[model samples]
Target: MTKPIKILSFNIQSGMGMDNRRSLSRIAWVIKCSGADLVGLQETDKYMKRSCFSSQARKLARLLGMHYVFGGACKPAFFSRFGNTILSKYPIKGHKNTLLPGTGEQRALLDVLININNKKIRFCNTHLGLSTSSRQKQVNKIIELLGEIQLPTILTGDFNTTPNDPVIEQLRACLERKSVSTESKNNDLKTYPSDRPSEKLDYIFLSAHWKEICQTTLPGQASDHLPLLAAARFIS
Candidate 1:
């Protein structure tokens, strides 16, 4: 029997905390405390000035001793290369980044393949658009990309919308029938505006090929959005 996969999804906001202090160490500590097997991160910097022109993904991966892949969505005014990141305990066999359709900021989806206990697993990470209409179109594009999944897959990231939003419904229509729960002890479970969260933005999704063990949104702190932790077992 294969062990369950421990997963975490966080939008680190380029490693800035609620106090306006930038510390990758703090971000790494949050992830380490989770004991996660795989992590999907958003708003990461690739040699950006704000982050001291350092590779934030590489730094965090090194801190956790995990393999990482940084997908650059776009460069803002030639100041930084920003996008999504995936950190995993297992070696990445292959990966790709798909640019989503949007009128606002350029967005991207990162899909990576890895083998765990002889099981092929696909980890899909993304940060969707901000506006409702843009998010709707981005969700449609993501659905098409997820269609190629031939193995057990976990889709996660900061989706920038409440669970009941129509965009989520559209995504549900494409995902395999499975219960994707986001229950936390804290009843509200909001994730934006770190100081006092007021929105359910981050998420973790599992395919029917997997069974959910548990899921929850961690308290906001290191970023504008709180981190979401989820665990599941792959079904043969």
Candidate 2:
């Protein structure tokens, strides 16, 4: 029997919680408690003064004892960069970062290949733009990239849009929404504005080769957005 893989997606808002506190340790603690074998993070800062110039991705990986790769969507300053990151308990074999089409703040898709249980699997992490037009274009680009990968893939991120949005609808046509559950009660799928989550912005999509076991949002004030966690086993 194959072990179920635990996956998590979170938009940490540079480690700022709803209470306006910035603590990477808190974020790490939430992830650690989740016991996620794979984690995709958005809005991470690298050498940014606002977050005390800490390398958020590296620090979290170190704290959790995992391998990680960061993709900078934009460099607001010469020494500071912000973007998405992926952490895995397994070894990362390769990675690529591509900037998406957007008129507002730059966004990126981080594609990574990792060896999990001696099997290669592709993991893609991204953060979409706020505008509908930009999100449409970004979604198109993501779909295009997804077509090029042959391995069983898992895509996770903070899409900045609700589940009913057309962008999400388009993605559903190509991949399975692994984080959504029919049995969820009391709006458990909502992941934004952690204090009072009223929107479903974060998501995890998996290829047909995986079967979802369970999914839920982790409770924590580590960031403005709550973490989405899911477990699945490879069908093959």
Candidate 3:
């Protein structure tokens, strides 16, 4: 029997009016068309330039009929900026959203618990810093934050660092410490440079506690970056 779990991670580029100034609809379309069970969104900016309207997070959730979560870019979120957001079709048990310890355009890690057929799956999503050095620090902070989570986990997001980078190497080591079989042959799909992709800054890594059945990148253009999706069967 085959149980397919559709997971997707996208850095929507803050919807900075690039899609004919139709950010909300674009996001909704992506959510609807992609048909993801769980989605991790980076650069999921939740506010208008003037902060007059509802958050983009709430708007997108309402549109997709999914539970929503957001991690503010600041530790205390002094400026009330959006960092990362997660949308889940399944009922959420709980979540932890917080900013990474760094001084940049504001970044955060969102830890959410999702109930899948009476089983809980933990998702850790985040968008890392832009610079290499900043990304290193951000990756370290993410690792630190992840240590607190006690559940079957799937780390998905636009980490902003390629697999070759030292930061990414360290992150890979610290996370997914348990070795799982990788049956995916689509690891070569690049996700950045939206127009014509190159390099993989996004990923969906399984925890030792779960057995990944399949993984691949969704094909289509819904945003600046392509989405990375994976399906895993929990080991009982």
Estimate the Cα RMSD of every predicted model relative to the unseen true structure: 2.2, 2.4, 2.9
Which regions of candidate 3 deviate over 4 angstroms? 16-20, 50-52, 74-80, 148-150, 181-187
Highest-scoring model, lDDT:
2
Candidate 2 structure quality by residue, lDDT tens digits, 82-124: 9999999999999999999988999999999999878999999
The clash number for model 2 is 0
In angstroms, give how far residue 206 of model 2 lies from its true place.
0.5
Per-residue error at 208 for model 2, in Å?
0.3
For model 1, the local distance difference test gives 0.84
Which runs of model 1 end up more than 4 angstroms from their true locations? 77-79, 178-188
**Which digits, one per residue and each the tens of the lDDT, describe model 3 over residues 48-97?**
45334457788889999999888777433334466788899989889998
Give residue 182's error in model 1 in angstroms.
7.0
> Global lDDT of each model?
0.84, 0.89, 0.74
Model 2 segments more than 4 A misplaced: 177-188
Task: State candidate 3's TM-score.
Answer: 0.86
Lowest-lDDT window of 10 residues in candidate 3?
A: 45-54
